[model samples]
Target: MVPLSFANQEFTLTTSGALYWPGERALLVADLHLEKSSFYAKHGQMLPPYDSRETLERIALAIRETGARRVFTLGDNFHDSEGSARLEPHAAGMLSALTRATDWVWITGNHDPHMEARAGGEIAEELEIAGMVLRHEAKAGETRPEFSGHFHPRLQISVRKRRIRRPCAVVSTSETSGGRMILPAFGALTGGMDAADPAILAAMQPAERIDAMLPAAGKLVQFPLWRREQNLV
Candidate 1:
């Protein structure tokens, strides 16, 4: 099921908990550390090397399903400077095919500010389109709404009184006057930190406006962000 929308717009930003702009026919993803597994493997951490493929596949599917013409990434597109260089041949092919026609935009993130220049896309610290601003980090002071990804938002969803701590899209209603939405990490293997994190949680209001939920196969399970103690990552 698609996640519900908070703002009334033509795009129907399906709360699939996935950041999709139906109006622009664009798919938005953030924090896709494409070669993170390889980065770890080099350090002897022994992670599955298929992360690049998996991440790209999911992104591909999302684009196809949304019929998106463009893709906007919030940041952390690569684990490090050497991430794209170490990709397995097949994974590289997958990525190549995925971006053959669609336009890709990579906003500067802390992990790789030069990603746009190095990753076959345009690079910028922030983007303003159709009255909305895009960036890697939420601007501390802004009047209009902003979209970004860095802290993968997740919630502690309760089912039958049992809590399931899972990653989710975190939107901030307080910052930017309820104009900021934090896109969840798009990396297939990336984990999230708690939305209640001091640095991240401060953006939320204590009066229960935050909507945290996990998109299960059939339902979007909702929960309060402040009540959970478990970390999303």
Candidate 2:
């Protein structure tokens, strides 16, 4: 884990794509997409059926590492609404244990808008806590400090002639509104969009700068994505 400061709040970013808030003793993860592999197999794609298990294990590890008492899943808790019903016994047991051990809240997303409490967590469309807006997608023209996940932003760069891609958090900072961040997908089977994609940039509008951030070797590395130009009148 590495230290990260956003919207005047200190957080730790885990390599597993989770954010730990020491102040709140909360662990925030985005895009769990549980049972995604099973969903694929339903269409004859034949993916391994252990994605939910792996994802749940990671979340468990994160909780232990952070000693978090609250677990908030930003969105897309499952690949689909019926994902919980298809969970294998072992994975379902793991999820049950975790939820029973903590205060778990599932913030609904586009993929799992109708997700229910059968998964053992409270369901909510969005939340506002400690002056921060938590939601599934970044809303255009939102000025408050916001944290969201949906785009699964990834940083793609050519290093030594080799194209390397890494999951990253895209943060946009504004003079008035503080900052907004799009967290990388935490699911095992999630895909990503370019960090600097126009759609992402546009969603973070009214910003003076945007950057992609990730931890490397216990340090935070930032790659600038966009910067507001001066003297543009």
Candidate 3:
């Protein structure tokens, strides 16, 4: 994990893509998309069928590594509304154990907008914590510091003449709107949108600077994605 400061608060970004909030002793992850493979298999696309288990295990590992007493999932906790029902017995057991061990909050997302809290955790459309809004998606007009997930931003960079892509969080900061960070998808099966995509930039507009960040080799590797060009009044 490496220190990442945003909105005047300090956080740690784990290599596995989980964000650790030291002040709150919490772990924030986004877009679990559990059971995504099963959702695809239902449509004649047979995936490995172990996506849910893998995702659950990673979450557990993150909690253990961070020693987080609370967990906040940004959204799409499951691939679909009925995904929880399809959780394999082992994966279901693992999830139950994790929830019982910590304070878990599931924020609803487009994919699981109507998800219920029957899965052993609290449910919310959004959450306010330590002066920051935590939600599933970033609202362009929101003026407060916000932490969200939905874009699953990835940064593609060339290394040694070869191109590589890594999941990253896009951080946007502006004097008027404070700061907004969009976390990468934590699920194994989730796809990514380029961090520099116009849609992603627009979502985090009114920015002085925008950066894509990820943890690498015990350090936070930050790439400047965009900056406001100087304008004369």
Candidate 4:
């Protein structure tokens, strides 16, 4: 985990794409997409059916690593609205245990917008904490420090003549809105969007600069995507 300061709050970025808030003792993750395999299988696409279990186990490991008493999921908690019903018994048990152990908040997203907290957690459309907005998608005109997901940004770089891609947080800073960050997808089965995509840059608008961040061993790697020019009108 590497320390990152945003919205005047201290946070630790885990290599696994989790944000740990030390002050709140909270663990934040995005786009869990649980039961995604089952959702695909329903449409005649066969995939390994253990995605939910794997995701749940990772969440549990993150909690243990951070000693977090609270958990905030930035949407897409399940693959679909009915995904909760498709969770295997063991995965369901694991989820129940985690929720019971911590204060879990499921921020509704496009995929699971009308989900119920049947696995023992609170449901919310979004959350505000320490002046930072937490949501599933970035509001184009929001003028406050925000943390969100949905883009699943990834940084693709070439090292030693080999292409390497890693999940990353897309962060942008603006004089009006403070700072906004989009977290990488937490689901093992989730796909990634390029961190430098124009759509992503436009979403995090009103920014002086934008960068993709990845936590490495004792350091945070930043790849700048955009920067306001001094001579641009």
Candidate 5:
């Protein structure tokens, strides 16, 4: 099986919005939005109630596949404060089971500020373990091997005149100390924006390097993260 890029130092990142640090044998995920479908359903969208089940199932499968004994949620692991509350009992049970199997840390996200307190995991605005900064948002005027989420980075690739945008992990090649990485959304229902577009660009250096996980190519592809010529939205 083709594996995603894992940081050589302490934390290894996967294109699936997950990470693996060999030192801790931990699996990291970002923007899970576990009950996203339910959140939409509550607003009368009435999407299938299978979002939670599907998300948990995928995470579980990743754990089993990687043999990871720990799990860390970068942020936005929950759709909203009440999203988990809306979960079907079985869905909640499934999540609990996943947490029970490993050391789970639920970092705070913009949407789920109460995740740590409500969910069965430790809460932290950001964590520094083994020389890496794990946070929800990218810090301003600070650079220390930051690993974060919230950008929901996506890559736009044109395949035969058709432009296809796919959610992806963005790792910076600037820092000497393992650099930075932005995870894609792992939830089944959370919406995302293409990182290749100007509207998606923030303080990003524009000339930075990008590595996109191409499962179809069985390898991470390197690209020049050039400035977006136009904005979409």
Candidate 6:
């Protein structure tokens, strides 16, 4: 885990794509997309069916590492609305134990907008805590400190002639209000978008600067993504 400062608050960003907020004793992860493999199988595209178990295990490890008493899943807790019903017994048991261990909140996302509490957590469309907004997708023109998921931003770079892509958090800073951030997807089966994708840049608009961040070798590395053009007098 590496320390990150955003919106004047301290957070720990784990390489596994989980964020731990010490102030709230909370672990925030995005886009679990649980049962994603099952969703694919339903469409005749068979994939390894242990995605949920793996994802849950990762989350469990993060919780243990952080000693977080609360967990807030930014969005897309499941791949589909019916995903909870399809959880294999073992995965289901794992999820149940995790939820029971902490105060869990699942924010609805486009993929799981109708998600319920069947998976042993409270369901919410969004949350406002400590002057920050937590939601599934970042809203353009939002002025508050915001944390969201959906884009699954990743940083792609060439090193020694080899192209490497790693999941990263995209953060936007503004002069007027608390900054905003779009967290990387934590799902085992999830793919990522380029950190500088236009959609992501647009969603973080009304900002002076934006960057993609990830932990590397015990240090936080930042890659500039977008910067507002300055006017010449």
Candidate 4, 34-110: lDDT as tens digits: 99999999999999999999989888999999999999999999999899999889999999999999999999899
TM-score of each: 0.83, 0.97, 0.97, 0.97, 0.85, 0.97
The residue ranges of model 3 lying beyond 4 angstroms of the native Cα positions read: 230-233
* Cα lDDT of model 6 by residue, 25-47, tens digit: 99999999999999999999999
Write the residue-wise lDDT of candidate 5 on 79-186 in tens digits: 887776777888888888887788888888999887544447677888997777888876643456777778787778788999988877666554434556777788
Model 4 residue 22 CA deviation (Å) reads: 0.9
Candidate 5 regions off by >4 Å?
A: 1-15, 116-119, 175-177, 198-201, 205-214, 227-233
Q: Model 4: number of clashes?
A: 0
Candidate 5: C-alpha lDDT: 0.70
In candidate 3, what residue range of length 10 has the lowest lDDT sum? 224-233
Clash pairs, model 1 backbone: 3-15, 3-16, 11-23, 145-179, 192-233
Can you give the lDDT of residue 82 in candidate 6? Answer: 92
- What ordering of candidates by lDDT runs from best to worst? 6, 2, 4, 3, 5, 1
The lowest-lDDT stretch of 10 consecutive residues in candidate 6 is 224-233
Query: Per-residue alpha-carbon lDDT of model 1 for 30-140, expressed as tens digits?
Result: 888889988888888998789988888888777767788888888888887567778889988877766666887777688876553433666677887777788877655
Residue 139 in model 4: lDDT: 83
The prediction achieving the highest lDDT against the true structure is 6
What's the distance in Å from true for residue 139, model 6?
0.4
- Alpha-carbon RMSD, candidate 4: 1.2
Per-residue lDDT value at 11 in model 3: 94
Off by over 4 Å in 1: 1-3, 10-17, 116-119, 158-161, 174-178, 204-208, 217-221, 226-233
Per-residue lDDT for 1-233 in model 3, tens only? 89999888889999989999999999999999999999999999988999989998999999988899999999999989899988889988989999999999999999999877656999999999988999999888788999899999999989999999999999998989769999999999999999999899889877888899999889999999998874224
Task: Please give the RMSD to the true structure for each candidate, in Å.
Answer: 4.7, 1.2, 1.4, 1.2, 3.9, 1.4
